[model samples]
Target chain A: MKAIIVDDERLARTELQRLLAPFKDIQVVDEAVNADDAIEKISKHQPDLIFLDIQMPGKTGFDLLEELDNVPYVIFTTAYDEYALKAFEVNALDYLLKPIEPARLESAVNRVLEKSKKEDTPELKSGKLKADDQVFVKDGERCWFVKLEDVRLLESEGNYVRLFFHDHKPLILRTLNYLDERLDPKTFFRANRKHIINLKWVENIEPWLNGGLLVKLKGGQKVEISRRQSIKFKDILSL
Target chain B: MIFSVTSVVVFTTRLLTAQDFSVGMIFANMVNISTVILLWSAIYFFIHYFENLKRSEIERLVWEAAVKDFELKTLKSQLNPHFMFNAMNSIRALIEENPERAKTALTQLSNIFRYSLRIERTETVPLEDEVKTVEDYLALEKIRYEERLNYNVEIDPAVKSIEIPPMMIQTLVENGIKHGISKYPKGGELRLKAVSVNGHAEIVISNTGSFSEEEMKNSKGFGLDNTKQRLNLLYGSKSEFNIVNDNGFVNVILKIPPGGRQNESYNS
Candidate 1:
């Protein structure tokens, strides 16, 4: 696995490089002190993984992810543990705290090796729509690491799912069912067969014909919840 | 009381009504003059007393707040000396085992120390700069722990521009190793995460060990408590902190109002 250590601290980069010396399969391609530097290096190296530090001089690890057109596998390294669980829920393969133990580093690297075999799989196919998770959206020349919370609506037409967020509607070649299986049910609700709406985005809900439900999302789009699903929704929400 | 006295004086006596007055009227006027002077002084005394009391109360509150702020700062500043001495001691152990690495670590240590030394000029440093210094300190520590220590940091890039008190996160990271990870034979994992919210930053420090109430209390004596106090002092009601040990992990969560570059009026 080709990897780059992105940290403002030279000693930390050096220490991580030294720790990886025994793992011959993984090569440390380069080092970046900040997010902008990492972006330039990453675009050039296009490494398999990044030993990224959350804090840097200019851009944070998050800002780096925001700038990337294609995100490599990330294993976050830092001195604090606060964002560890949240990062794990996102796309990060693993989250390691600092002073990095050799054994843990090996295991994290080994997971990356295992993951490389299945790198083609889409990220949102596995987990809930966490507030931190950034999904890749390519709309012609423009792209975004749109947070799940920012995504107001997901409408399906055939196999393509049009993701609606902040006025841009980008279509990805995936079925609504595929997204339904991955997105957090609490945040992303199947309003109907064709649409999955973020619950947090619901601004108003009213009764519709035939025991159905109408929900107005924050962005002003209205979605209908089938009577059957409404029951389940009420149960989940305990409303 | 003055209104009643004035009304009584006005109704009981006719003042300057007569061009010429007898000695009895003169004596009465003299008494009235003294009475008016006494009433005026009485009103002035009450005003002065209440004003002084309110002023003193305000002074006390300001002093108390200042003391709390200083206590937190002193606690935070103490970490550097405490950490420096410990690093020196660790280097002492490494000198004979690996001379070259020790020399390198010593230099790295100085660099890390210098990064934080700039903190005196400003209450908060850019989030990323502080993280870099912490990472430098960890590199030196890696020499001592070898394979026993592990860590990962993931911060939202949005927060890189934000400012926080220097060494706030670093202090917690050091405490995680000293109090939680170092105890177990196999050691533990430490992870740091920063997430930028709308106008604030959320920081979490987690370690792979649990602590009893007593142990947690003991650790809170200075390290974690100091962090809590400092955060409160710096951000006041805008910040919040909580520590929870659940299912074998110790987590410290801090919500700090982001002191972005746009706002420069800090040392207030």
Candidate 2:
């Protein structure tokens, strides 16, 4: 497995690289200091995996993941344990704390090798969202590992997006545009700029103001479908 | 000059009316006596009214000065050495293990200090700003407590524009952790929920910690008392605070009036 190490600290990058030297199957392709450099290196190398640091100079490791259209397997290296839950929500392979325990690091690498093997096999892209497909949402101290199907609605509030699932709503540091690209278009419909409704969760739909439509979800929350998105909603729903 | 004329008139009348000189002298003596009495009464009333006004003005000044001093001291006392000690310890742990996360934690710590120091000079900050500061503080605590301490904050976007007393919610949250969750072996959850209800903004901090009656009675932390005093000074009877224990959880509720001159002047 080919990999790249992205960390601001030279000592940290060198130490991690040295630690990985014993794994004959893993090859250290390149290293970058920050998110921009990582992006360039990642695009150039197309490595199978990345060792990401959660915090950096400008963009965070999470920010780097946000920029990617297809995220490779990631193992987050951070000293703060607070982000462990959040990193899991982002579907990180594993989170290794600083000083990098040898046993834990070996386990993370083994998991990567296993995941790569699974990816090599051909598989159908199923319509139903799986438990492994998780979205990141941070609301104060609570971060959620939300399945795409579990999320009933995505409401836009200024610069942030609110994910509504179950009884809790978490505001994530993401824009509607950012979510629009990553979400599977078939299951998640952009009802309007202000809202993205899960297609399977829509309970009823009715005509509303100015040729638009109002979509009521299984949870009984109403979302307005704009004239532009209304057409798309109808096409997807076969109305 | 007016008093002197009255006195002169009295003297002349007294001299002229040594005996019963004439009816005119008697009338003049009576007029002189009445004028003197009227002049003295006017002078006495003037002095009394002005003195009362001056006294009230001085009283108001002293009260305001005392309140300001108390607020400053309370803010300082709340964000003292203990908070720094905990934060530094967390940073120390992060520095050796996770340099990147350590850097992020450091940045967050700086933001908390900046928000706190700026608020020390302010009477009330926008509710949005206060919420942000509390979030920063909680983020730091999350680093320390890790998974043991979890929180959920739900705030209405509309209420974000409203004004609230600085450090009011932070103090409540701190107290919830210190007196409530910190004692628990497994630790517990903390939640802050804000909503606009019935022309008032209601904030509730619910934590998964139990408190006995004795503990409740003995809850004499300076942070809680300071928060109560601040609420009283800012909103008087218009704001209310209550602590309730249910099942195995403790919840603190704070309610403040929605609309008043307090909002207008605060934004200004």
Candidate 3:
């Protein structure tokens, strides 16, 4: 598996690389000094896993994750930040403290391998996000790795878009038009100017005034399809 | 019962001395003995009560000193594990790059840990000793921060023997690094100067960063507040602590009076 190490300290990066030398299955692709550097490298290499340091010079590891659209499997590395450690505990995520022990590193790497094996999906080369693609969303102190299939609706509010999935409606720094372009048109339908509905989650559809369609989602959210989009939706559904 | 014994003794004495059976003289002698015995008892009890009060007062003072010592120890223990782990990480890397420097770095780390542990047993340490520890601390941090951290220490020999609270200078210097130097992306310089000013050891630690009101409110109070309480406890109002943002630098000044060893006698 391709992996990247992100830490501001050169010595810390060197130490982590030395420890990972024993694990032949995991290859260190590149190193990033801070959050911005990590973001740039992550997009360039598209590593499968990252050993992230929570504290850096500019932005923290969490800030880097929040900025990513497709977040890889992450194993956090921190010195002694109790607040960051608490977040890991709540999320049940893997983390290694500094002066990392060999046994703990081995276990963390093994867990990453096991998780990747369970999710052995092919990467989409078409540049469009598929139903299997997972996006990272962080709201305040809470974070989630939400799959596109699970998202039933997305509503636009100014420059941000709010995603509805599993009783969560956390807003992300994305626009509806941008998501509509990136998402696969076969699954996600642009219901109106303000809403995008997942076709798989359409529970009830009824004709509304002015020939528009009213759609109810499985998650009990009501979305109105514009008259022009409703005709296209019926054609796509063949009804 | 004691009253009766006194009365019998007094009556026998009166009878023997008078050589006659006189009830009035015997009763008068018994009354006089009773009054003398009461006066003696009052004096004895008063002395005993006064001694007990004095002992309890001493005990209370000792207890208060113990609590203050414990507080100081706890404050010292908050030596920032973040620094510990980061230092170890640096040493691990140095092992491959420069082994000799790595060994020296290891020694420095141990020195800091040892000093922190030993400081709990004493309230104040000589300026020379504390300065050595702080130098070791800065050397290790220099390795971690590399070119980003630059520090200069100037100590006046006159104030080297003057005793100040253990880790007082070190703590302020650390604050300068944590809140000031480390905040900048390009990093900045730290200057520590210890001089004798008007019979008081005036130590000033200045770094290249701003100590704005917003950051002062946002930062955790454990380190700065702990330093304040410790200074107040050890030197009462004699010691002075002042922090301000001047130009582009944050300056922390500590004025410690000589012989600030209030808790030294408590060890016995």
| lDDT of candidate 2 over B93-160, digit per residue (tens) | 56767889889888888887888888766766788887887888888887766666788889988677
Stretch of 10 with least lDDT, candidate 3 chain B: B259-268
| Winner of 1 and 3 under lDDT | 3
**Which candidate should be chosen as best, given lDDT against the real structure?**
3
RMSD of 3: 11.8
Candidate 1 has an lDDT of 0.75
Off by over 4 Å in 3: A121-125, B1-73, B261-268
Candidate 3 has an interface RMSD (Å) of 1.4
Compared with the true structure, model 3 gives a TM-score of: 0.80
Of candidate 1 chain A, the 10-residue stretch with the lowest lDDT total is A120-129
Per-residue lDDT tens digits for candidate 3, residues A127-232, read: 7788877887888877777889999999999999999999889999999999999999999999999999999999999999899999999978899999999989
1 versus 3: better TM-score goes to: 3
lDDT of 1 by residue, B1-268 (tens): 8778777666555553454367547756876997879888998999999999999999999998898767645765534444564456556556655789889889989888787667766777888998887778778666655566788888889888787878888888888877655554356788889998776888888888876778666554577777776676677778888888867888988888865333334355
